[model samples]
Each structure stands twice: as structure tokens, then as C-alpha cells.
Target: MSFQEISPADTAESLRNGNAVLIDVREPHEYGAERIHGALLYPMSTFDPRALPIDSSRDVILHCGSAKRSGMALMRCAEAGVPINKHLAGGIMLWKREGLPTIKVDPATGRVFDPQQG
Candidate 1:
């Protein structure tokens, strides 16, 4: 089954409008390092598409550091008969390249990173 892919900017817009749910399929450490604000953690290593909450009212968008894992997650969903709304075309890398806002947490100190200070 074919799946839909959305651009990072469009995904960000959908998220801002509360019309989509962004699921990050990367590992916890990766997520903690940097991630799109408000994205839900669903690591691909231990992901169960069947366990994903189904909300007909909103779109479900899956993503990872790159598109590889997210693409695999989409296949898993399809195999499980779960209907995914869409996925980020190029994942978080693309999102960051687009200059979309993200939340960065320091794993050691649990402090938030200031983008401007970087």
C-alpha cells in the first residue's frame, strides 16, 4: 500500500493548526537531543503500530532523524492494517534544514538549549 508524504514546512503548519500528530520514530536519546516541539516519542526500535492511538479527526505523521526508519514504521503500520495519514518526506533533518523551530534538551543536565546561543 502506498503512503502519503508531506514536506516539513507543511507538516509544521499542520502541527500549528492542530490538524496533525507528529510521531518521532527515532531513539529516545536522539529525540532528547533535538526534535520538533510537541512530537510524540515512538521509537522505531520498540514501536508497535498497533498500539498507536487512532484519531480519525487528526492526521498522523511519522518521522525520524532521517526518513529511513519512519518509512519502515509506515510499512509496519501497513502490515498491521493501521492507516497512517502521512510522513515527513525527509524527516527531522529536512525539518531542521527548513529552519522550523525545535526543542533541544541536554541529556546530562536536562536543560533546554537556546538556538540563538548556538
Candidate 2:
């Protein structure tokens, strides 16, 4: 199964408009360090395609720190009979490079921190 790759900016916009669901396939620690705001945690290490929210009306976009992990997740999903075809082209690294916003999660308290506020 092939997947569609979207730009970070486009993905952000789609997410803001509720046109898509962003799934982050990175590890928990990586998610805590930095992640696209509003992305759902679905780490590849413990990924369960069946556990993913199924909403045919909404588009699902998977991503990781880079496209590598997300790509792997896509394959896994396909193998499991889960049809996920969209992903952030370059992942969070590209998202950051595109000047998009991300929230840093406080591991201890699970609080979200503003990336611009240091």
C-alpha cells in the first residue's frame, strides 16, 4: 500500500481545521522532548493498528521524528489491515524547520510547555 506525503504547513493547517488526525509514531521520550501540537501518541514500539481511532470521515496522518519511523508504522498498519495512507512528509524535524509550532511536554508533571517561551 502506498502513502501520501503532506508538507508540514499543510498538515498543520489540516489539523487546525479538523480535517485530519495526526498520529505521532515516535517513542514516549521523543514525544516528551518535542512534538507537533495536538498529535496523538501511537509509538511504533507499542503500536496497535486496531487501537487507532477509526473515523472514515477524517484523514489520518502519521509521523515520527523523521519519516523513517512513520514509514515503518505505515507498513505495519498495512500488514495489520489498517488503511492509513497519509503522513507528514518530513516529520517533526521538518515541521520545526518550517517554523511550525510544537509543544514540549514536562515528563515529570505531564504539563505542556510553550516552545517559544524557553
lDDT of each: 0.89, 0.88
**Clash totals, every prediction:** 0, 0
Candidate 2 lDDT by residue in tens digits, 57-94? 88999999879998888888899999897889989999
lDDT of 1 by residue, 18-37 (tens): 99999999999898889888
Instruction: Please identify model 1 stretches exceeding 4 Å from their true place.
Output: 107-109, 114-118
For model 2, the stretches where C-alpha displacement exceeds 4 angstroms are 105-112, 115-118
Deviation from native of the Cα of residue 38 in model 2, angstroms: 0.7
Model 2 clashing-pair count: 0
lDDT of 2 at 47: 96
lDDT of 2 at 62: 95
Q: Best candidate per TM-score, number?
A: 1
